[model samples]
Target: MQEATADTFIVRIGAVSAGTIAEDGEYPGLWGAWDQDGQFMGRHASREGVAAFLASCFIVDEQDWS
Candidate 1:
């Protein structure tokens, strides 16, 4: 949906659900990201990777947790 990233996004480094985490990935936990509109953008193998990737073209509003 137009890659909506004009707003802040959340970068979480943990398992959101069961049986979806990769034990062999670079990051043990599941690195997932969602846009400001609560839409899941993507998942990565590393926290830094996901953060950097999302931050590249979008603004990460760490303060807007709600």
Candidate 2:
């Protein structure tokens, strides 16, 4: 992950862009999520909330892999 600005970040998965998380411009203290293609995902009350959302979207489940 890289800090794009004071209120925005570029999330990555080993150099590949996963998505972005940024603060809501209209609502202070809220954050928004977007895909790498720049599609608006959703908004959250906290940065951690948005981050977890991005993780759930990008991270693949590997429990079946022995």
Candidate 3:
């Protein structure tokens, strides 16, 4: 396991659920949601544009998981 810094940012986007994008200590990329059983549930893009899109749509107070 690894640790995250305050500068690290994670972006999530979806209709029903959200997933992580560019988590701390992990390689820069997109991620998707998983079921309670840890099975993948959906898809998300990891492109630079996708990351920017996620950031643009993000709302801190509504989605803050910190």
Candidate 4:
């Protein structure tokens, strides 16, 4: 058996929305997340998912987004 080790990574949040209004007068928005190296992690339907994924990982730099 091998011992478990944690790998550290930096995460960043991005907007997956097109930022355009639809003909129905509705705007679409989504929470997109990625790693420090600009690697695609996953697409989330809600901002909570993005935050959850980031929290699940061993993040090194928790940059101030707010």
Task: Pick the lDDT winner.
Answer: 2
lDDT against the true structure, per candidate, is 0.45, 0.81, 0.38, 0.39
Cα TM-score per model = 0.43, 0.75, 0.25, 0.39
Query: Sorted on lDDT, highest at the top, how do the candidates line up?
Result: 2, 1, 4, 3
lDDT of 1 by residue, 1-66 (tens): 122244323433242211111222334565665554655566777756666665543533433657
lDDT of 3 by residue, 1-66 (tens): 011234333334444223233322333354443332444334355434434444444444256687
Q: If both were scored by TM-score, which would come out higher, candidate 1 or candidate 2?
A: 2
User: What is the model-wide C-alpha lDDT for candidate 3?
Assistant: 0.38
Kindly provide the TM-score of model 3 when superposed on the true structure, using C-alpha atoms. 0.25
- Each prediction's number of clashing residue pairs: 0, 0, 0, 0
> RMSD in Å for candidate 3, one decimal?
10.0
Model 2 C-alpha lDDT per residue in residues 16-47, reported as the tens digit of each score: 77789998888888899998888888899988
The segments of candidate 4 whose C-alpha lies over 4 angstroms from its true place after superposition are 1-28, 59-66
* lDDT score of residue 35 within candidate 2: 87
Error of 1 at 51 (Å): 0.4
